[model samples]
Target: MVRYYGIFFQEDGQWSVRFPDAPSVNTCGETVDEAIEMAIDALSAMMVLGRKGREYGDPRGYEEIQAEAKDGELVFPVMPAEKAMEAYRPKKRINVMIPVDLLDRVGEFLKNRKGLDRSKFICNAVESHLQQNVEAH
Candidate 1:
């Protein structure tokens, strides 16, 4: 998952924040604090909308649920593009067992048409699952 922020300054001396991947949101403040308050309100409203509309292709719109906020800003889960790339370098080895049904389902994933080792497939799956629930502050 990628999280990006955009700040827009209004003519009325207010500032607005936005999530590029999520256009439904725009937070604004009168002063920086007030605008931050308003932006939080906007972020909340946008989440409600995303949930209702099933944004991000998740019926629960769980991605819209942010982590506990910090400094009045709503944050979503993500890896910086460069850091994410680094994750693939010098990976370690581990093993675990899943239920037969679960393993079968993972095996059925289309992206692994040719083949997908459990580790790589699980990594991708975990990332996708995290996008649905994990978030930052």
Candidate 2:
């Protein structure tokens, strides 16, 4: 786990955080503590982007970072609780073509269902089918 120093700035009663090592990484919150929490999420996303771009950089030293801080800007350590990609699991949107009759049936099934949707139904059906196939094999 890499430790990056975050520079916290308060403006208009909101606390915002910025990482020097990653200029694109930033977050804001109503309070300092909240901002720190958001910093973890922001940093994790930055790590993922860096990995994808193949342009990741090492964290700068605290002394060096502190020296660059402004008069009221607070410098502190911000480390992600988990690995970069593990911290954020982005869902992918897929477009699937189903028979007109099947799509109509799905709409009817979900019409009265309070929480269930067509996508969730399809996912559950796929998972159950996969499990059954695995067991059969």
Candidate 3:
């Protein structure tokens, strides 16, 4: 888990939140608690994008942020929970062709591995093969 610093403040009677590390992320709420919850949601969304290989700016130091903070502004840290990460991993279905013998072997192997499923096993195998070939080049 990674912790990110956020700036929370009230503006026009509404609480707003922004992450210095990721300026693109901003959220607002009717109350401080609500603002924090919204900030968590925003952070989770950003983490999902990062997991999908999106780039973000580096975080600002807490001291620097403290120096720059306006009156009534507060700094808080937020981290994406495991449930958030799991929720972000969306799965897709695809069709592939393979030999009947290979399919049978895979099925047998999966049956032996209690929690492993066919799609996950195949995906892992393909990813491993691709990585090996890429490294060989």
- The candidate scoring highest on TM-score is 2
lDDT for every model? 0.52, 0.85, 0.80
Among residues 3 or more apart in sequence or in different chains, the pairs in candidate 2 whose N, CA or C atoms overlap within 3 Å are none
Instruction: State the lDDT of candidate 1 residue by residue for 41-102, as single tens digits.
Output: 55444443343454553222224443322354444332234433444345667777789998
Choose 1 or 2, whichever is better by lDDT: 2
Clashes (N, CA, C under 3 Å) per candidate: 4, 0, 0
Please give the lDDT score at residue 42 for candidate 1: 55
TM-score of each candidate structure, all chains considered together:
0.31, 0.61, 0.59
Model 2's C-alpha root-mean-square deviation from the true structure amounts to 5.6
Maximum-lDDT candidate: 2
Order the candidate numbers by lDDT, best to worst: 2, 3, 1
Off by over 4 Å in 3: 51-54, 93-137
lDDT string, candidate 2, 1-137, tens digits = 88899999998899999888877788999999999989998888766545545464788999999998999999989997675455465667988889999999999989999868887789779989999999999
Candidate 3 at residue 136, lDDT? Answer: 100
Candidate 1 residues lying further than 4 Å off, grouped into runs, are 1-10, 51-54, 57-137
Q: Pairing residues by index, what is the TM-score of model 1?
A: 0.31
